[model samples]
Target: MSTRSHSAVMLRRNFKHVARNPTSVFNAVLMPIVMMVMFVYMLGDAFSVGVDYVDYATPGLMLMAVCYGLGAVATAVNSDLTKGIINRFKVMDVSRGAVLTGHVVASVLTNLIAIAALVAVAFLLGFSPSAGLFDWLGVVGLVVLLGLAAGWFTVALGLAAKSPETAGLASVPLVMLPFFSSAIVPAEKMGPGLREFAEYQPFTPVIETLRGLLAGAPSAGDAIAAVAWCVGIALVGYLWARAKFSKRA
Candidate 1:
């Protein structure tokens, strides 16, 4: 079979895995909603600074949702690795890259759905921002890129893990990354050391870009930086995962 056909078959299998195990999807959607609610109701008035906290926070929550979805990818990949599924595939005539590609594609699609659910809940909670059609499109594109980057990175982690538990633990730092970024609060408000780290970290520029796009205040620099970070992460992760897979296989 062609590489594309191999990938398509694996993709279908991954989707069925998702269907059989729905908690990953549920948790991906739930974490952001719970965070949004807690932040908006519990701290919105204090943190909003005269603007709508929901609007100010929703972009960050969306990004966090993407991060949360990575945990699922890691878990799924690790399960397959540990359960000998990958080993079985190695004996078959499957395209070498198709297995990982299938997981990445399915994880990206799942993340998009989680993002939509987060946005819907945000709107219901009074999160509103002004953005043109093109802006929205840009936001979606940016989000997909971010998801791809993060998903691949998690796939690498999953492949490297000896067990599913280790894979889940490995992704904890990714979930916590946005908290240290400009996602939850402005980096300027942080201490000097932390501010520097938060400003320069991978998640910061992406969060800022999303915020800018959704608020109708797009920044060319931030957009460029976000895309650069996503591409860089994706390339590194793809190479790392490919090498790891080959070595193991």
Candidate 2:
């Protein structure tokens, strides 16, 4: 079978696994909504971002949804590795790209679903965006780009982890990075030492670009930086994952 065909087969198998075990889905989907409610209700009034707390926070939450969803990708890939699923596929002549592609695409799809659900809840919470058709398209494109990049990175983490449990733990940084970002409040609101860090961290530009798109006035500089970060991470992740898979399988 062609790589595409092999990838499709792997994709189906991965989805089946997800269907049987929905823990990751809850982590990726429900956890963000919980956080959203917590932020917009329990904690929103404490901040003074220029816009509605919901509106300001929605973009950040969307980015968090992507970051938070990566644990599943790592865990799923680790499960396959430790269970000798990849070794079995190796004997059957399955391509490495096919295996990882299945995880990456599936991760991206699940994250999109989570984002959609989050957006729905955001609307219900009085989150209103100035984005138009093009703006929405930009949002999707950027989210997918980030998802693809982070998916591969987490897949590499899974490959590198000692076990499935460790793989879940390995993804903690991705989950935590957004909190330190402009997600909950404006970066300027943070104290001086932390503010500088928040301004330059990878997630910041991406979140800012996303916020800009939703507001119908995205910054070109931020978009450039965001794309550059995504591309660099994806390349590093693909190469690292390929090397690890080659050695193991």
Candidate 3:
């Protein structure tokens, strides 16, 4: 079958799967909302860094949305593996890209809803984007790319996991990287050595880049760092996931 035809079929099948499981939808939207509310209210005072903490936090909340979106890839992959659905796909004449396109596209769309909800919540709490429409589009584009790269890594994790619990536990590190970087606080607040490390951490640059875009500031260094991290993660994740998928197949 043609790749497009295959992708359409797979997309339909996956959408059906999601539709049948309404609880997954609830969790996808609920989990991110909970995190956004929890951190913006509880941790805002503890990590005051000279800005409206919510404004500073909007990017971080967006990142969390991306992270949660990526988890859908992991969860779907895990569900397929647990039920031998992947092996069934292997027996079909489906194009390889079909599986990926369906899962990733559905995931991105679902997450966009959560993103809109989160943005609305942020606005309700006094967070406003200083960025113009084009710049805001750029932010969304960058976020989708970042989420795509991260999604592959999570796919690999789900493929390699021994159980659903292991897959769930594995997401912790993925979500924590942003918190440890300059996402919440200014990196300067850390010890000198830690500050330096935070400056160099992958998420720090991405967060900084997004911050500049959202704040209506143009920052070349931040843009370069964000692109670098996205590309690097995509390369590593593709390599790892390809290797694991080959072995599993």
Whole-model lDDT values for every prediction: 0.88, 0.91, 0.76
1-249 in candidate 2: lDDT tens per residue?
999999999989887776567687788889899989999988989888878999999999999999887877898899899999999998999987999999998888888999999999999999999999999999999999999999999999999998999999999998999999888888998999899999999999999999999999999999999999999999999999999998876
**Candidate 1 error regions (>4 Å):** none
Span of 10 residues, lowest total lDDT, candidate 2: 16-25
Range of the 10 consecutive residues with the lowest summed lDDT in candidate 3: 64-73
The top-ranked prediction according to TM-score is 2
Model 2 TM-score relative to the real fold: 0.97
Reference-based lDDT, residue 184, model 3: 72
Model 3, residue pairs in steric clash = none
Higher-ranked by lDDT: 1 or 3: 1
Per-residue lDDT tens digits for candidate 1, residues 128-175, read 889899999999999999988998899999999888989989999999
Deviation in angstroms for 42 in model 1? Answer: 3.1
Give the RMSD in angstroms, all C-alphas superposed, for model 3: 2.3
Residue pairs clashing, model 2 = none
